[model samples]
Target: MKVHVHVSLKPGVLDPQGRAIHHALEGLGFIGVNDVRAGRLIELDVADDTSDAALDDMCRKLLANMVIENYRIEKVAA
Candidate 1:
Protein backbone atom coordinates (compact mmCIF):
# COMPACT_ATOMS: atom_id res chain seq x y z
CA MET A 1 0.00 0.00 0.00
CA LYS A 2 1.06 3.53 -0.68
CA VAL A 3 0.42 6.35 1.76
CA HIS A 4 0.96 10.06 1.43
CA VAL A 5 1.18 12.39 4.39
CA HIS A 6 0.59 16.10 3.92
CA VAL A 7 1.93 18.15 6.76
CA SER A 8 1.54 21.91 7.14
CA LEU A 9 1.49 24.68 9.62
CA LYS A 10 -1.78 25.49 11.32
CA PRO A 11 -3.54 28.80 11.22
CA GLY A 12 -2.02 31.62 13.26
CA VAL A 13 1.41 30.06 13.10
CA LEU A 14 4.32 31.95 11.63
CA ASP A 15 5.83 30.49 8.47
CA PRO A 16 9.08 32.11 7.49
CA GLN A 17 9.62 29.87 4.49
CA GLY A 18 6.18 30.66 3.17
CA ARG A 19 6.83 34.36 3.58
CA ALA A 20 10.07 34.06 1.70
CA ILE A 21 8.43 32.31 -1.19
CA HIS A 22 5.69 34.91 -1.36
CA HIS A 23 8.21 37.67 -1.42
CA ALA A 24 10.23 35.97 -4.12
CA LEU A 25 7.15 35.61 -6.28
CA GLU A 26 6.43 39.29 -5.99
CA GLY A 27 9.99 40.08 -6.85
CA LEU A 28 9.66 38.02 -10.02
CA GLY A 29 6.76 40.28 -11.20
CA PHE A 30 4.01 37.89 -10.30
CA ILE A 31 0.71 39.54 -9.49
CA GLY A 32 -2.57 38.70 -7.78
CA VAL A 33 -0.74 36.57 -5.23
CA ASN A 34 -2.08 37.06 -1.76
CA ASP A 35 -0.24 34.60 0.44
CA VAL A 36 1.71 31.40 0.47
CA ARG A 37 1.78 28.55 2.96
CA ALA A 38 4.54 25.99 2.91
CA GLY A 39 3.98 22.33 3.59
CA ARG A 40 5.55 18.92 3.11
CA LEU A 41 4.53 15.65 1.51
CA ILE A 42 5.79 12.32 2.76
CA GLU A 43 5.29 9.12 0.80
CA LEU A 44 5.31 5.75 2.47
CA ASP A 45 5.02 2.23 1.17
CA VAL A 46 3.74 -0.10 3.84
CA ALA A 47 2.16 -3.48 4.07
CA ASP A 48 -1.38 -3.81 2.78
CA ASP A 49 -2.49 -4.85 6.24
CA THR A 50 -1.32 -1.64 7.87
CA SER A 51 -4.16 -0.23 9.94
CA ASP A 52 -5.43 3.31 9.86
CA ALA A 53 -4.76 3.65 13.57
CA ALA A 54 -1.09 2.92 13.06
CA LEU A 55 -0.80 5.44 10.25
CA ASP A 56 -2.47 8.11 12.32
CA ASP A 57 -0.14 7.33 15.20
CA MET A 58 2.84 7.72 12.89
CA CYS A 59 1.71 11.21 11.97
CA ARG A 60 0.88 12.28 15.49
CA LYS A 61 4.03 10.89 17.03
CA LEU A 62 6.69 11.66 14.43
CA LEU A 63 5.41 13.03 11.12
CA ALA A 64 3.65 16.10 12.45
CA ASN A 65 4.23 18.46 15.30
CA MET A 66 1.06 18.49 17.39
CA VAL A 67 1.90 21.94 18.68
CA ILE A 68 1.49 24.09 15.54
CA GLU A 69 1.16 21.74 12.62
CA ASN A 70 -1.62 19.71 11.06
CA TYR A 71 -1.46 16.56 8.94
CA ARG A 72 -3.69 14.60 6.61
CA ILE A 73 -3.22 11.03 5.47
CA GLU A 74 -3.99 9.91 1.93
CA LYS A 75 -4.02 6.34 0.73
CA VAL A 76 -3.10 6.07 -2.89
CA ALA A 77 -4.86 3.81 -5.32
CA ALA A 78 -2.76 0.99 -6.62
Candidate 2:
Protein backbone atom coordinates (compact mmCIF):
# COMPACT_ATOMS: atom_id res chain seq x y z
CA MET A 1 0.00 0.00 0.00
CA LYS A 2 1.08 3.50 -0.74
CA VAL A 3 -0.07 6.63 1.03
CA HIS A 4 0.34 10.30 0.36
CA VAL A 5 0.05 12.87 3.12
CA HIS A 6 -0.32 16.57 2.55
CA VAL A 7 0.37 18.95 5.39
CA SER A 8 -0.39 22.67 5.19
CA LEU A 9 -0.83 25.59 7.48
CA LYS A 10 -4.34 26.75 8.25
CA PRO A 11 -5.54 30.05 6.92
CA GLY A 12 -4.67 33.15 8.95
CA VAL A 13 -1.22 31.79 9.64
CA LEU A 14 1.59 33.91 8.24
CA ASP A 15 3.78 32.14 5.69
CA PRO A 16 7.06 33.97 5.49
CA GLN A 17 8.78 31.49 3.22
CA GLY A 18 5.89 31.55 0.80
CA ARG A 19 5.90 35.34 0.89
CA ALA A 20 9.57 35.46 0.04
CA ILE A 21 9.15 33.02 -2.81
CA HIS A 22 6.27 35.03 -4.17
CA HIS A 23 8.35 38.16 -4.06
CA ALA A 24 11.20 36.47 -5.88
CA LEU A 25 8.87 35.23 -8.55
CA GLU A 26 7.49 38.71 -9.04
CA GLY A 27 10.97 40.14 -9.34
CA LEU A 28 11.66 37.60 -12.07
CA GLY A 29 8.79 39.28 -14.06
CA PHE A 30 6.22 36.57 -13.51
CA ILE A 31 2.85 38.25 -13.66
CA GLY A 32 -0.39 37.41 -11.91
CA VAL A 33 1.51 35.71 -9.14
CA ASN A 34 -1.15 35.83 -6.50
CA ASP A 35 -0.85 34.61 -2.96
CA VAL A 36 1.47 31.75 -2.09
CA ARG A 37 1.15 29.12 0.61
CA ALA A 38 3.80 26.53 1.38
CA GLY A 39 3.12 22.93 2.24
CA ARG A 40 4.65 19.45 2.43
CA LEU A 41 3.93 16.11 0.81
CA ILE A 42 4.84 12.83 2.53
CA GLU A 43 4.79 9.57 0.63
CA LEU A 44 4.88 6.25 2.38
CA ASP A 45 4.59 2.63 1.37
CA VAL A 46 3.12 0.44 4.06
CA ALA A 47 1.85 -3.05 4.43
CA ASP A 48 -1.45 -3.85 2.77
CA ASP A 49 -3.07 -4.37 6.12
CA THR A 50 -2.67 -0.76 7.20
CA SER A 51 -6.07 0.67 8.08
CA ASP A 52 -7.52 4.14 7.82
CA ALA A 53 -7.63 4.39 11.56
CA ALA A 54 -3.94 3.59 11.75
CA LEU A 55 -3.12 6.18 9.07
CA ASP A 56 -5.09 8.79 10.95
CA ASP A 57 -3.17 7.94 14.06
CA MET A 58 0.07 8.34 12.14
CA CYS A 59 -0.91 11.78 10.96
CA ARG A 60 -2.01 12.91 14.37
CA LYS A 61 1.07 11.54 16.05
CA LEU A 62 3.88 12.39 13.66
CA LEU A 63 2.79 13.68 10.24
CA ALA A 64 1.01 16.84 11.25
CA ASN A 65 0.88 19.46 13.93
CA MET A 66 -2.76 19.80 14.86
CA VAL A 67 -2.18 23.13 16.58
CA ILE A 68 -0.86 24.86 13.43
CA GLU A 69 -1.43 22.64 10.43
CA ASN A 70 -3.96 20.32 8.83
CA TYR A 71 -3.37 17.01 7.03
CA ARG A 72 -5.04 14.86 4.44
CA ILE A 73 -4.36 11.19 3.82
CA GLU A 74 -4.69 9.32 0.55
CA LYS A 75 -4.13 5.59 0.30
CA VAL A 76 -3.58 3.39 -2.72
CA ALA A 77 -2.78 -0.22 -3.31
CA ALA A 78 0.54 -1.17 -4.76
Candidate 3:
Protein backbone atom coordinates (compact mmCIF):
# COMPACT_ATOMS: atom_id res chain seq x y z
CA MET A 1 0.00 0.00 0.00
CA LYS A 2 1.07 3.56 -0.62
CA VAL A 3 0.59 6.13 2.11
CA HIS A 4 0.52 9.75 1.12
CA VAL A 5 0.81 12.51 3.68
CA HIS A 6 0.27 16.21 3.35
CA VAL A 7 1.53 18.57 6.01
CA SER A 8 0.56 22.21 6.14
CA LEU A 9 0.63 25.10 8.54
CA LYS A 10 -2.51 25.70 10.54
CA PRO A 11 -4.43 28.86 9.92
CA GLY A 12 -3.15 32.02 11.67
CA VAL A 13 0.45 30.82 11.74
CA LEU A 14 3.09 33.02 10.12
CA ASP A 15 4.56 31.66 6.89
CA PRO A 16 7.55 33.68 5.73
CA GLN A 17 8.51 31.34 2.94
CA GLY A 18 5.00 31.36 1.54
CA ARG A 19 4.94 35.14 1.80
CA ALA A 20 8.21 35.39 -0.08
CA ILE A 21 6.92 33.18 -2.85
CA HIS A 22 3.79 35.31 -3.11
CA HIS A 23 5.84 38.46 -3.38
CA ALA A 24 8.04 36.94 -6.05
CA LEU A 25 5.03 35.94 -8.05
CA GLU A 26 3.68 39.50 -7.94
CA GLY A 27 7.04 40.82 -9.07
CA LEU A 28 6.89 38.48 -12.02
CA GLY A 29 3.56 40.11 -13.08
CA PHE A 30 1.34 37.35 -11.75
CA ILE A 31 -0.92 39.62 -9.73
CA GLY A 32 -3.99 37.45 -9.72
CA VAL A 33 -2.77 35.48 -6.74
CA ASN A 34 -4.19 36.86 -3.52
CA ASP A 35 -2.52 34.51 -1.12
CA VAL A 36 -0.23 31.54 -1.01
CA ARG A 37 0.43 28.80 1.50
CA ALA A 38 3.18 26.25 1.37
CA GLY A 39 3.06 22.65 2.50
CA ARG A 40 4.87 19.33 2.12
CA LEU A 41 3.92 15.98 0.68
CA ILE A 42 5.35 12.65 1.78
CA GLU A 43 4.74 9.37 0.00
CA LEU A 44 5.54 6.06 1.59
CA ASP A 45 5.24 2.44 0.56
CA VAL A 46 4.22 0.22 3.45
CA ALA A 47 3.12 -3.33 3.90
CA ASP A 48 -0.48 -4.04 2.94
CA ASP A 49 -1.26 -4.91 6.53
CA THR A 50 -0.43 -1.46 7.85
CA SER A 51 -3.37 -0.17 9.84
CA ASP A 52 -4.92 3.28 9.61
CA ALA A 53 -4.19 3.80 13.30
CA ALA A 54 -0.49 3.18 12.74
CA LEU A 55 -0.41 5.57 9.83
CA ASP A 56 -2.09 8.24 11.94
CA ASP A 57 0.45 7.66 14.64
CA MET A 58 3.26 8.08 12.12
CA CYS A 59 1.87 11.47 11.15
CA ARG A 60 1.56 12.61 14.73
CA LYS A 61 5.02 11.38 15.66
CA LEU A 62 7.19 12.14 12.64
CA LEU A 63 5.36 13.23 9.54
CA ALA A 64 3.93 16.46 10.96
CA ASN A 65 4.35 18.96 13.75
CA MET A 66 1.13 18.78 15.70
CA VAL A 67 1.71 22.17 17.30
CA ILE A 68 1.58 24.26 14.17
CA GLU A 69 0.93 21.89 11.29
CA ASN A 70 -1.88 19.58 10.32
CA TYR A 71 -1.61 16.42 8.24
CA ARG A 72 -3.88 14.30 6.12
CA ILE A 73 -3.27 10.75 5.01
CA GLU A 74 -4.43 9.01 1.88
CA LYS A 75 -4.04 5.41 0.90
CA VAL A 76 -3.29 4.77 -2.72
CA ALA A 77 -2.95 1.61 -4.72
CA ALA A 78 0.56 0.30 -4.83
Candidate 4:
Protein backbone atom coordinates (compact mmCIF):
# COMPACT_ATOMS: atom_id res chain seq x y z
CA MET A 1 0.00 0.00 0.00
CA LYS A 2 1.00 3.57 -0.58
CA VAL A 3 0.20 6.57 1.56
CA HIS A 4 0.70 10.23 0.92
CA VAL A 5 0.95 13.02 3.45
CA HIS A 6 0.68 16.73 2.82
CA VAL A 7 1.83 19.11 5.52
CA SER A 8 1.22 22.82 5.29
CA LEU A 9 1.22 25.83 7.55
CA LYS A 10 -2.10 26.98 8.87
CA PRO A 11 -3.52 30.39 8.04
CA GLY A 12 -2.10 33.38 9.93
CA VAL A 13 1.16 31.54 10.63
CA LEU A 14 4.37 33.23 9.64
CA ASP A 15 6.06 31.61 6.65
CA PRO A 16 9.41 33.22 6.01
CA GLN A 17 10.45 30.63 3.46
CA GLY A 18 7.29 31.11 1.45
CA ARG A 19 7.69 34.84 1.51
CA ALA A 20 11.24 34.58 0.24
CA ILE A 21 10.12 32.44 -2.64
CA HIS A 22 7.37 34.86 -3.47
CA HIS A 23 9.84 37.70 -3.57
CA ALA A 24 12.14 35.76 -5.82
CA LEU A 25 9.34 35.05 -8.20
CA GLU A 26 8.45 38.71 -8.40
CA GLY A 27 12.04 39.60 -9.08
CA LEU A 28 12.00 37.21 -12.04
CA GLY A 29 9.33 39.35 -13.73
CA PHE A 30 6.41 37.15 -12.82
CA ILE A 31 3.20 39.09 -12.56
CA GLY A 32 -0.14 38.65 -10.86
CA VAL A 33 1.38 36.63 -8.05
CA ASN A 34 -0.39 37.51 -4.90
CA ASP A 35 0.91 35.07 -2.29
CA VAL A 36 2.91 31.93 -2.04
CA ARG A 37 2.54 29.14 0.49
CA ALA A 38 4.77 26.12 0.64
CA GLY A 39 4.10 22.66 1.87
CA ARG A 40 5.67 19.20 1.88
CA LEU A 41 4.64 15.90 0.43
CA ILE A 42 5.61 12.56 1.93
CA GLU A 43 5.05 9.22 0.27
CA LEU A 44 5.12 6.06 2.31
CA ASP A 45 5.09 2.41 1.47
CA VAL A 46 3.46 0.34 4.18
CA ALA A 47 1.88 -3.02 4.62
CA ASP A 48 -1.48 -3.52 2.99
CA ASP A 49 -3.01 -4.19 6.35
CA THR A 50 -2.00 -0.84 7.78
CA SER A 51 -5.01 0.82 9.30
CA ASP A 52 -6.17 4.35 8.58
CA ALA A 53 -6.11 5.13 12.29
CA ALA A 54 -2.44 4.23 12.48
CA LEU A 55 -1.63 6.52 9.58
CA ASP A 56 -3.48 9.36 11.21
CA ASP A 57 -1.55 8.72 14.40
CA MET A 58 1.70 8.92 12.50
CA CYS A 59 0.81 12.36 11.18
CA ARG A 60 -0.29 13.65 14.57
CA LYS A 61 2.78 12.37 16.37
CA LEU A 62 5.62 13.13 13.94
CA LEU A 63 4.54 14.31 10.52
CA ALA A 64 2.68 17.49 11.42
CA ASN A 65 2.71 20.13 14.10
CA MET A 66 -0.91 20.43 15.12
CA VAL A 67 -0.47 23.91 16.55
CA ILE A 68 0.64 25.55 13.30
CA GLU A 69 0.44 23.01 10.52
CA ASN A 70 -2.29 20.82 9.03
CA TYR A 71 -1.98 17.46 7.32
CA ARG A 72 -4.00 15.53 4.76
CA ILE A 73 -3.71 11.82 4.07
CA GLU A 74 -4.39 9.83 0.91
CA LYS A 75 -4.14 6.12 0.42
CA VAL A 76 -3.15 4.69 -2.94
CA ALA A 77 -2.87 1.35 -4.56
CA ALA A 78 0.67 0.29 -5.16
Candidate 5:
Protein backbone atom coordinates (compact mmCIF):
# COMPACT_ATOMS: atom_id res chain seq x y z
CA MET A 1 0.00 0.00 0.00
CA LYS A 2 1.02 3.58 -0.59
CA VAL A 3 -0.04 6.81 1.01
CA HIS A 4 0.31 10.46 0.12
CA VAL A 5 -0.01 13.35 2.52
CA HIS A 6 -0.34 17.00 1.67
CA VAL A 7 0.38 19.55 4.35
CA SER A 8 -0.49 23.20 3.96
CA LEU A 9 -0.93 26.34 6.00
CA LYS A 10 -4.37 27.19 7.28
CA PRO A 11 -6.24 30.02 5.68
CA GLY A 12 -5.20 33.52 6.77
CA VAL A 13 -1.63 32.38 7.44
CA LEU A 14 1.06 34.12 5.41
CA ASP A 15 3.31 32.04 3.14
CA PRO A 16 6.53 33.90 2.32
CA GLN A 17 7.93 31.09 0.18
CA GLY A 18 4.78 31.10 -1.83
CA ARG A 19 5.01 34.84 -2.28
CA ALA A 20 8.58 34.56 -3.53
CA ILE A 21 7.60 31.87 -6.01
CA HIS A 22 4.78 34.06 -7.29
CA HIS A 23 7.20 36.89 -7.87
CA ALA A 24 9.56 34.59 -9.75
CA LEU A 25 6.71 33.47 -11.96
CA GLU A 26 5.83 37.05 -12.75
CA GLY A 27 9.44 37.80 -13.63
CA LEU A 28 9.31 34.88 -16.04
CA GLY A 29 6.37 36.65 -17.78
CA PHE A 30 3.49 34.52 -16.61
CA ILE A 31 0.41 36.76 -16.28
CA GLY A 32 -2.98 36.66 -14.64
CA VAL A 33 -1.64 34.63 -11.73
CA ASN A 34 -3.49 35.85 -8.72
CA ASP A 35 -1.76 34.18 -5.79
CA VAL A 36 0.38 31.28 -4.70
CA ARG A 37 0.61 29.12 -1.63
CA ALA A 38 3.32 26.55 -0.98
CA GLY A 39 2.82 23.24 0.72
CA ARG A 40 4.41 19.82 1.23
CA LEU A 41 3.73 16.32 0.02
CA ILE A 42 4.80 13.21 1.93
CA GLU A 43 4.68 9.73 0.51
CA LEU A 44 4.78 6.51 2.45
CA ASP A 45 4.89 2.86 1.57
CA VAL A 46 3.30 0.72 4.22
CA ALA A 47 1.96 -2.71 4.89
CA ASP A 48 -1.26 -3.76 3.24
CA ASP A 49 -3.14 -3.74 6.52
CA THR A 50 -2.24 -0.23 7.64
CA SER A 51 -5.27 1.68 8.85
CA ASP A 52 -6.51 5.16 8.10
CA ALA A 53 -6.84 5.95 11.79
CA ALA A 54 -3.19 5.12 12.28
CA LEU A 55 -2.22 7.29 9.34
CA ASP A 56 -4.24 10.15 10.73
CA ASP A 57 -2.49 9.77 14.01
CA MET A 58 0.86 9.89 12.29
CA CYS A 59 -0.12 13.15 10.62
CA ARG A 60 -1.20 14.72 13.87
CA LYS A 61 1.76 13.52 15.83
CA LEU A 62 4.65 14.16 13.45
CA LEU A 63 3.71 14.70 9.84
CA ALA A 64 2.02 18.06 10.32
CA ASN A 65 2.09 21.00 12.69
CA MET A 66 -1.44 21.50 13.92
CA VAL A 67 -0.85 25.06 15.10
CA ILE A 68 -0.44 26.34 11.55
CA GLU A 69 -0.95 23.55 9.05
CA ASN A 70 -3.60 21.06 7.98
CA TYR A 71 -3.06 17.70 6.36
CA ARG A 72 -4.93 15.56 3.85
CA ILE A 73 -4.26 11.88 3.25
CA GLU A 74 -4.72 9.73 0.17
CA LYS A 75 -4.24 5.97 0.03
CA VAL A 76 -3.28 4.17 -3.14
CA ALA A 77 -2.93 0.52 -4.06
CA ALA A 78 0.51 -0.34 -5.28
Candidate 6:
Protein backbone atom coordinates (compact mmCIF):
# COMPACT_ATOMS: atom_id res chain seq x y z
CA MET A 1 0.00 0.00 0.00
CA LYS A 2 1.06 3.55 -0.68
CA VAL A 3 0.50 6.38 1.72
CA HIS A 4 1.12 10.09 1.42
CA VAL A 5 1.49 12.47 4.29
CA HIS A 6 0.75 16.13 3.72
CA VAL A 7 2.14 18.26 6.47
CA SER A 8 1.72 21.98 6.83
CA LEU A 9 1.80 24.81 9.33
CA LYS A 10 -1.42 25.69 11.02
CA PRO A 11 -3.08 29.04 10.64
CA GLY A 12 -1.52 31.97 12.57
CA VAL A 13 1.79 30.14 12.77
CA LEU A 14 4.84 31.98 11.44
CA ASP A 15 6.16 30.48 8.22
CA PRO A 16 9.44 32.05 7.15
CA GLN A 17 9.85 29.75 4.16
CA GLY A 18 6.39 30.56 2.92
CA ARG A 19 7.05 34.26 3.31
CA ALA A 20 10.26 33.94 1.36
CA ILE A 21 8.50 32.19 -1.48
CA HIS A 22 5.77 34.85 -1.57
CA HIS A 23 8.36 37.56 -1.73
CA ALA A 24 10.20 35.79 -4.52
CA LEU A 25 7.03 35.49 -6.51
CA GLU A 26 6.31 39.19 -6.16
CA GLY A 27 9.86 39.97 -7.20
CA LEU A 28 9.35 37.96 -10.34
CA GLY A 29 6.44 40.29 -11.36
CA PHE A 30 3.68 37.91 -10.36
CA ILE A 31 0.49 39.64 -9.32
CA GLY A 32 -2.79 38.84 -7.58
CA VAL A 33 -0.93 36.66 -5.12
CA ASN A 34 -2.22 37.17 -1.61
CA ASP A 35 -0.27 34.63 0.41
CA VAL A 36 1.71 31.44 0.22
CA ARG A 37 1.86 28.53 2.59
CA ALA A 38 4.52 25.93 2.03
CA GLY A 39 4.18 22.31 3.02
CA ARG A 40 5.78 18.90 2.66
CA LEU A 41 4.68 15.61 1.17
CA ILE A 42 6.00 12.31 2.45
CA GLU A 43 5.39 9.09 0.55
CA LEU A 44 5.43 5.73 2.27
CA ASP A 45 5.09 2.21 0.99
CA VAL A 46 3.86 -0.10 3.70
CA ALA A 47 2.29 -3.51 3.94
CA ASP A 48 -1.28 -3.81 2.73
CA ASP A 49 -2.33 -4.89 6.17
CA THR A 50 -1.13 -1.69 7.84
CA SER A 51 -3.91 -0.31 9.97
CA ASP A 52 -5.25 3.23 9.96
CA ALA A 53 -4.46 3.57 13.63
CA ALA A 54 -0.79 2.88 12.99
CA LEU A 55 -0.61 5.43 10.21
CA ASP A 56 -2.29 8.07 12.37
CA ASP A 57 0.14 7.30 15.15
CA MET A 58 3.06 7.75 12.77
CA CYS A 59 1.87 11.26 11.93
CA ARG A 60 1.11 12.28 15.49
CA LYS A 61 4.34 10.95 16.91
CA LEU A 62 6.90 11.77 14.24
CA LEU A 63 5.55 13.21 11.01
CA ALA A 64 3.76 16.27 12.38
CA ASN A 65 4.30 18.66 15.25
CA MET A 66 1.12 18.56 17.30
CA VAL A 67 1.40 22.18 18.38
CA ILE A 68 1.75 24.26 15.24
CA GLU A 69 1.43 21.83 12.38
CA ASN A 70 -1.37 19.78 10.85
CA TYR A 71 -1.21 16.64 8.74
CA ARG A 72 -3.44 14.65 6.43
CA ILE A 73 -2.99 11.04 5.48
CA GLU A 74 -3.84 9.93 1.94
CA LYS A 75 -4.06 6.30 0.96
CA VAL A 76 -3.25 6.05 -2.69
CA ALA A 77 -5.03 3.75 -5.11
CA ALA A 78 -2.82 0.99 -6.39
lDDT winner = 1
Give the number of the best model, judged by TM-score. Answer: 1
**Tens-digit lDDT string for candidate 4 (1-78):** 989999999999999999999999999999999999999999999999999999999999999999999999988767
- Find the 10 residues in a row with the least total lDDT in model 4: 69-78
Candidate 6, residue 48: Cα displacement in angstroms equals: 0.5
TM-score of each: 0.97, 0.92, 0.95, 0.94, 0.96, 0.97
lDDT of 6 by residue, 1-78 (tens): 999999999999999999999999999999999999999999999999999999999999999998999999999998
- Stretches > 4 Å off in candidate 1: none
Candidate 2 error regions (>4 Å) = none
lDDT of each: 0.98, 0.92, 0.94, 0.95, 0.95, 0.98
lDDT of 1 by residue, 1-78 (tens): 999999999999999999999999999999999999999999999999999999999999999999999999999998
- Per-residue lDDT value at 33 in model 2: 89
> Which window of 10 residues has the lowest lDDT sum in candidate 6?
60-69
Determine the backbone clash count of candidate 1: 0
lDDT of 5 by residue, 36-59 (tens): 999999999988888899999999
Better of 3 and 4 by TM-score: 3
lDDT of 2 at 51: 86
Residue lDDT tens for model 2, 1-78: 899999999899899988999999999999998899999999999988888999999999999999889999987556
Local error of candidate 1 at residue 50 (angstroms): 0.5
Clashing pairs for predicted structure model 1, backbone only = none
Overall local distance difference test of candidate 2: 0.92
